[model samples]
Target: MDKFKKVQDVIASVEADVTKFYEGGNAAAGTRVRKAMQDLKVLAQEIRAEITDKKNSAK
Candidate 1:
């Protein structure tokens, strides 16, 4: 559950960065957005694995 919140926070940050980059063409914001996207990918995978493990254990 904490990991889920962290992932949500990162996604919000990425959204902000993307909006900032589009509004002002900031290279730094673009870089941050890219990094956040990569982080999101990893976090999503981790959550997926955790859910699968829980589901299998329930059986």
Candidate 2:
């Protein structure tokens, strides 16, 4: 639950950064935004894994 919350927060932050980058019109910002988005995606996957592991362990 806590991990999911943290990941969700990170995702929100990354989303905000993406929006800022899109509005800023800087080429270099694109790379940073892409990287942040990728990291957030990976964090989401990790959160899924954590939930799955918890479920499996309970069973």
Candidate 3:
């Protein structure tokens, strides 16, 4: 749970940065922002996998 929260916090922080860059109107920054978003998605998937494994193991 703590690890999951930490990942969520990182994703939220990166998302905020992405929004800032996009609103500032920098094309190159937008590319980086998009890449960060992609990474956040992967983090989310990993967190979900961890949760699923815990659930399956409990049974």
Top candidate when judged by TM-score against the true structure? 1
| TM-score of each model, in listed order | 0.87, 0.67, 0.68
Question: Local error of candidate 1 at 37, Å?
Answer: 0.7
**Which one wins on lDDT?**
1
Please list all clashing residue pairs in model 3, or write none if there are none. none
Ordered from best to worst TM-score, the candidate numbers read 1, 3, 2
lDDT of 1 by residue, 1-59 (tens): 97899999998768878988999899999999999989989999999999999999999
- Every candidate's lDDT: 0.92, 0.75, 0.76
Write the residue-wise lDDT of candidate 2 on 1-59 in tens digits.
77667767766767756766789776676777788667778878888898899899999
> Once superposed on the true structure, which residue ranges of model 2 sit more than 4 Å away at CA?
5-20
Local lDDT at 17 for model 3 = 61
Model 3 accuracy (lDDT, Cα): 0.76
lDDT-better candidate, 1 vs 3: 1
